[model samples]
Target: MATTSDNQLRNPPLSDQARDRLRAAILEGELKPGDKINIERVAETFGISRTPIREALKALETEGLVQIQANRGAIVEPQVWQEIHHRYRMRSLLEGYAAELSCGKRDKKLIAALQDNWAQVKKAGQAKTVSQNSARSIAELNRSFHRMIWVGSGSMTLVRFLEALDLPQSFNDAFYKEQNARQVVCEHHGAIVDAFIEGDTAKASTLMERHVLDSVDLLASQADDHVSNLCC
Candidate 1:
C-alpha cells in the first residue's frame, strides 16, 4: 500500500489552494483576459513556491481559462464572441432537451427545488446596485437553478455534456452586469417554472432554449463594447 508521504506528494494541498486562488482571480476579472501570468509574481503574492503555481496553471488550462505557451508563461484566454455564441447555441440545444426530459419526468422534488432557487435569484436581484459581488452571487444562483434541471433530466451523459459546454464565470459576470439583466432573468426563470408547473414539456423546452439564446445578444453587445474600449 502507498504511504502517507506518497499520497501527500501526489496531491499537495498547496497546489490545490493555489489553483483555487488563481481560478478566483481569473473568474473575478482581477486577471483580465490576455493578461500574462508571471509565475514568480504570483508565487510571491500567494507566499508559496512556483511549482504549485505552475501546476495550478496547468489545471486552469484544461478548464479553458488560460493558455500556456512554450518558453513563455500563461495568459488568460480571450473571450471570442464567435466562440461564445457557438457555445450558447450548443447550450440551447442540450439544455433545451434537458428541460424537456425533466418536464416529462414531472419530478415534483425538482420543481420544488427550482422554485426555492428562483426565490433566491429574485432576492439577489433586489440588490440596490449591481457590483461584482452581486453579479457573482446571481451567477452562482443561476447555475444552481439550471443544474437542478440538468440533474432532473435523469441522464448523466446529458449532464456531463452540459458541464463540458459551460463557460467560465466571467461571462456570467458580464451578463448580470448589463442593464435590466436581473429583470430579464427573473421573468425567464419565472416563466420556465410556470411551464414546469403546468407539465408543459414543449413550453418548458422552448422557454429554456430561448432563455439561453437571448443572452447571446447581450453578451455580444458586451464583447463589442470591450473591443471598442480596447480600440479607443
Candidate 2:
C-alpha cells in the first residue's frame, strides 16, 4: 500500500487530484478506448494508494469516460462519433434557448463582461504560435464567455444541464489552436454579443445555435483522425 507524501497532504484530496489526472489522460488520448487502467500501477506512479485511484476511477465512470467491471479494472470508453454528434446537437438547442432567454434580460454589465472575456480570447488566439498554455487559456476564456450567457438566462436547470453536456477541455484545447477555427469562433462570438447588445433575441438564438453546430464537422473529422491513428 502506498502512502501519500507530506507534499500531497497540503494540496487537494489525493482522490480529486488522481481523478483530474486520470480524466486528463483519457481526454488527451494517453489512455485510448478499451485500455485497462492498471490501478496498482497508477497508484505507484502517483506515489499514493489504491484507494484514491479506485475513487478516482469511480468518479470518471459517472462522467462516462470509463466503465468499471466486476473483478476487473476500469476500461476507457469508446469515443463514439454518433454520441458526440448527438451531444453537440443537444448543446445547440439548449444553448440557443439560453441565449434567447439571456437576450431578453441583457444588461450593460453582462455585455461588458462578455466584451472583456472576448478581448482576452482574441488576444490569446492571436499568438504567433499556439502553445499548450495559450490553447488552454483560450479554451477557458471561450467557456467563460458562453457561461456568462448561460447564467444570464437565470435558469439554474439549463445551466446545470449545459455543464453536464460540455465536452472535455482537451477538445477545446485542440480546436482553438487552429488559426482558422479560432478566427471563426471569435467572429461568431462577436456577432452573438452584438445581437445581445441590440436585444435581438431571435438573432442571438440563431447565432448561438449556428455557432455551436458549426464546430461539429471539424470536431468529428478530428475524432476520426484520432481513432484512425490509434487503430494504426
Candidate 3:
C-alpha cells in the first residue's frame, strides 16, 4: 500500500501524469521488456516522490505493462510471444462475437459514425506518411471500430472488462512500433472497414480474427529482432 502526504497528493496530479509517461515509455520501447525501473530515478526525473510513482506503477501493473515484487519494485514484465498470441485469440473470439451481434443491433447512425472515424484514420495515415507514430493513430481508430461493436452488444460488464484489458498498450504497441507495421496495419484497416460496410457478419468475423492473428504472427516473428534492437 502506498501512503501519501495530504500536501503531496494535493500538490500535483503526479499519479496520472506519471502513468501516462510510463505507459508511453513502455509502448515506445524506451523501457524494454524485463527492464527494471528505478523508483528514485523516475521520481527525480518527474520531480515527484515515490508515493505517486508507486501509484502510477500500480496502474501499469493492472494493465500488464509492469510488475511489482516484494523484493524488487518495478520492472517491465517479459512478453511471451505465445501469450500474446493467446490474447489475440481471445480478442478475436470475443470481439468477433460482438461484431456479429452488432450487425443486427446497430443503428444507421452508429454505422455512419464508424465510417467517419475510419475516414479520419485514412487521412491521417496518408498525411503523416505512415510512420510508427502514424500507425498509432490507425490503431486508435481500430479500437474505436471494435469498441463500437462492444458498445452495441449491450453487455456492459463484458465491454467494461474488455476495456480493462488495455489492448492498446499491449497489442497495439507491438504492432505500431515496427517499421513495416504501419503499412501492414493500414492494409488490414481497409479490409476491416470494407467488411463492416458490407454488413456481412461472417466476413466481418473472419476478417477480424485473421487480422488479429496475422498481426500477432507478424509481431512474434520479429520479436527477437525487436528485443535485440530495442533492449539496448
Candidate 4:
C-alpha cells in the first residue's frame, strides 16, 4: 500500500482541531511565551500528521499566538511590549464605550451583582498567600464584572467584539499577581462600577480607559522584570 502525501491527508477541519488545541496550550501558558514549539513533537503528541500541525501553526501565526522565525521554526509569540501596548490601547477604547453604555442602562440589579463580585475579588486579592485557586477565582470574578458591564451595554455586537479580543488566561493570572496590580485592580474596577451606578456615563467611560491603561503599564513593568514569573 502506498502512503498518503501531506497534501492529501491534511484538511481544513483537521487543521482547525489542531489549531484549537495548540491555541489552548498557548493561551493557558502551557506552551509559555517565547518558547519554541516543536511541530514534529506536537504532531506526535496529538497523534496527527505533520501536515495538520503545520497548517495549524500557520493559522495560529495569523492569530498572533505563534510566529514563524528564520531558522527557528514556530515559536509561541512572546507578549511583546509593542503588541501589549497596541492591544491595551484598543481595549481601553472599547471598554470605555461599554462603561458609557452601561451607565445609560442604570441596571440596578446588574450594578448590585457587579459590586458583590468586585468585593469578592478584592478580598481574595488581599490574602497573604495567593494560591492557584485564589488567583483563578479572582480572575473569574474579574471576568464576571467585565462581562456584566459589557452585557449592560445592551449591544450584542459590542459584547461579541469585546469577547473576540485576545485576552490570555495566563496574562490575566500574571497581571493580577503583579505588584500593586491587585490593589489597583480592586479600586479601579470598583470605581467603574460606582460610576455606572451613579449614572455618570462620562466618568464611567473615563475610568474604564484609565483602568485599562493602568493595567497595561503594570503588566509591562512587571513583565519586563519577571516575564517567566508572571506568565506561569
Output the number of the lDDT-best candidate.
2
Instruction: Evaluate model 2: give its lDDT.
Output: 0.81
**lDDT tens per residue, model 2, 84-194:** 567889999999999999999968899889888877877778765798888888899999999999999999999999998886676678777778778888888989989
Q: Per-residue error at 23 for model 2, in Å? A: 2.4
140-206, model 1: which lDDT tens digit per residue? 9999989999999999999999998775666677678765778789889999999999999999999
- Regions of model 3 farther than 4 Å from truth: 1-13, 79-86, 128-140, 167-182, 214-232
Model 1: per-residue Cα lDDT at residue 89: 96
lDDT of 4 by residue, 1-232 (tens): 9976787656437787788777756544467678888877787778889898889889888877788899988887886345657777888899899999988888889888988988888888886567666777787788888888888889898898888774656557656664477889899988987887789999999999999888777765564453222121
Q: List ranges where model 2 is wrong by over 4 Å.
A: 1-10, 79-84, 167-181, 215-232
Give the lDDT of residue 109 in candidate 3: 77
Q: How many clashing pairs does model 2 include?
A: 0
Error of 3 at 38 (Å): 1.3
Which one wins by TM-score: 1 or 2? Answer: 2
Candidate of highest TM-score: 2
For each predicted model, how many residue pairs clash, with residues at least 3 apart or on different chains?
0, 0, 0, 0
In order, what is each prediction's RMSD in angstroms? 5.4, 5.3, 5.5, 7.5
Candidate 1 to native Cα RMSD, angstroms: 5.4
lDDT of 1 at 127: 66
Residue 83's lDDT within candidate 4 is 62
